[model samples]
Target: MQNLARAVLVLFGLLVLAVACIAVSIEGSEPSVPLTEEDVIGTWQGDRGARLEVTADGRARLSDASGWRCFKDGQAGVFTGEGSWIMAQHSDEGPGILVKFTVDGAPATQCSDHFAIHRADTRDGGDVWARWLGTGSKEPYRRTPTG
Candidate 1:
């Protein structure tokens, strides 16, 4: 009985910790600057070979990126494809984007997925933009990280 009671306590503690982590991720994701469409017009890279190229004319391309709203119909290899994006607003991260993915030039069904955006608070002020990949982790694809 004592061992079971200890296990319950441990599980409860873990649950609380998970919730706290989510809260922090959402709260601290505030944008450092007022993000515009032009601000995100650059190539943002993240860990694990993820690449998001945003062009000035509302074109976007993703390579090995996640938090995707497409590929719902057992579509494979569409992760690395062309798409279009527009400036959007997220409740947690404020200014965001909706990347409407496409598979070989056709819209990939309601690909209008919302993702968070943030800017790094650096001294260099390099106008870096970060795309929040709110999957199982909080990974940011920052553009031009300079010292």
Candidate 2:
């Protein structure tokens, strides 16, 4: 009976050690790098064939031939907006880019204009991922080739 109890205690100790190692590994990971205009000035494709275009002058356009269902106000199709993007430190997720824009000629309440973009470590060949801040919808976007 004593030997069995000792074995159980040793197993519990090993489990605790494993958990600690995983925690340390996650905490020691490096943060994401900041993005610049060169990094984001291009077309990005989202889920359901949606497209977002960012221009060098800080202008942006969101277009979907079907619709942007996330908009609660039922305004869909195309939207023209302008805003600047910046690389900032996220409190929990390390470095990320914040995109702030407003739909042109739409009510302020109809649009949730903030988004977060982060570099996806799992991707190669200049692919990044983004999420809408209000609806929590995520999508992967690849840079469109430019000449």
Candidate 3:
């Protein structure tokens, strides 16, 4: 009876050790790296009828446009308006970019998965544009980001 109990204990210990080793091995495995500009260079289509293609050369073509725009080293667009531009991120709100161009006169901000456009003149009573790229029923073109 003693020998049988000892054998069972040893088997249980071995099983526990094996499980621990497997867990450690899984944890130590390399994690996946996020896609860089190269991976995202090609055109990407969203669930809605929107498409965006980012060029490795710093040009971005949005929504099947006829041509692309040069972003000038990630700082091409200018934000302009009145009240402080704000970017709503998480629960905390952040500063928004003031775009000055006539085409993109609306103030804007880039967040994790979306960009917002706000009118600076109104200050507190401006409209808030949400980034949705028209994926669902509502036709919104607020470009969201993906990791």
Candidate 4:
């Protein structure tokens, strides 16, 4: 009975350590600098055929030629949405933005609602990168060239 109890305690300790490691990995690093509307305003295209158009007036439009994996509410195929956005500092993730919008003219889904964009590159025709709020994976976006 004592051996069984010791094994259970060891398992619990391993579980706790695993959770702590996950938490640390998910936390975002400090931003090099604050992000502004002007910095984000423009047409950004993702590698996955996703496009984001942020306007100076706090308006945003999102379109995905191929349905986004993040939207798992049976929302697939060409999707378009319009919504408002704002830049804010996350307690654990440094700087980020919260975008509230509906998909397919339906009520907004919970997924892909927030993004933590890092200001790592200079704002002049440089690549801007962002990631989902709770995940460490990043997606790179480039500004569409204008005439």
Candidate 5:
């Protein structure tokens, strides 16, 4: 009985440690250098037709830049709009970008979305931005060559 208990404890400890390591890798640390508005000014593309542009003038442009199953009002359509954005740094949130844009101007009828952008570590090239989708998930956007 004692041996079995010890083995179970050891396995649980190992499992916890593995999970912690994975969590750390997934929630990466702040960039080596703090992010700046100028640094993020460019075009970022992601899966689907999503594309985001951070202009030097503190504006953001979007093209098909919403979650999957894009909808307008009660209908369906891709999203495109322009809005203001800024580099935001909070003690708890670390460094991130807050983009507040609306899709009313687009041909689409009605829908809304917001973005909380953060830096994510990648295997190659520059760091990507993780656009949080509520508290459940995130979408990673990488800078494109043509943007």
Candidate 6:
């Protein structure tokens, strides 16, 4: 009886040690690399044909075909109904560019949908855009007109 109890205790200890080792290993693992602007520079088509694209030379072009516009890093342009944007930084959230339009024309931060844009719909849209490729998710973004 004594040996059986000791065996069980030993087994429990080993299990606990193994679990702790695994937890530590997981915790020590490196964080995932943040997506960059270059990774998100391409035409992105949404469910409703909402297309967005970031060019290689640091230009963001978005439009609904009938209506299209572009902007540069320090540049700003009209968005949806009453919105505009000013390109910003490229952070871990993804290649981010500042948006200045409606919502008060305040600086709106937009990250590349490729990294962690959340919503599956958004991700799908991003996939269509394909900006998350070549770019390292750390490249600068500038809004520039297509024409």
**What is the lDDT for 22 in model 2?**
97
Runs in model 1 with CA error above 4 Å?
Answer: 1-32, 66-69, 74-78, 104-110, 120-129, 132-138, 145-147
Summarize candidate 4's per-residue lDDT along 19-70 as a digit string, tens digits: 9998887564333556777666788787777788888888878776354443
lDDT, residue 49, candidate 5: 61
Better of 1 and 5 by TM-score: 1
- Candidate 6 stretches with Cα past 4 Å from truth are 1-31, 65-147
Task: List the candidate 5 regions with Cα displacement exceeding 4 Å.
Answer: 1-28, 68-77, 90-93, 106-126, 135-137
For each candidate in the order shown, give its overall lDDT on alpha carbons.
0.65, 0.59, 0.36, 0.65, 0.61, 0.40
Candidate 3 clashes: the total is: 9
User: Backbone collision count in every prediction?
Assistant: 0, 0, 9, 0, 1, 24
- Model 6 earns a TM-score of 0.32
Per-candidate Cα RMSD to the true structure, in Å, reads 9.1, 5.0, 16.5, 8.7, 6.4, 11.4
lDDT per residue, candidate 1, 1-147, as tens digits?
Answer: 999999999999999999999999977664455767766777778765678788888888777764443555544332566778888887665777877766544454444456566555534663455654442124566774423
Regions of model 2 farther than 4 Å from truth: 1-24, 27-31, 65-82, 92-94, 107-112, 122-127
* Clashes (candidate 2): 0
* Residue-wise C-alpha lDDT for candidate 2, range 11-109, written one tens digit per residue: 999999999999998766543455566767788777656677877776666655244433446654444454565555466654445656555665463
* RMSD of model 6 against the true structure: 11.4
TM-score of each: 0.58, 0.55, 0.30, 0.58, 0.55, 0.32
In candidate 3, what are the lDDT values of residues 45-146, reduced to their tens digit? 544455544444544434432211222244323221122122222223222222111123323532112222222223343333323211112233433445
Q: On residues 28-111, what C-alpha lDDT tens digit does candidate 5 reach at each position?
A: 664565666655678878666678888888888777644433344434445566677777754455665666565645554332
* Residue 10 miss distance in model 3 (angstroms): 8.3
Worst 10 residues of 2 by lDDT: 63-72
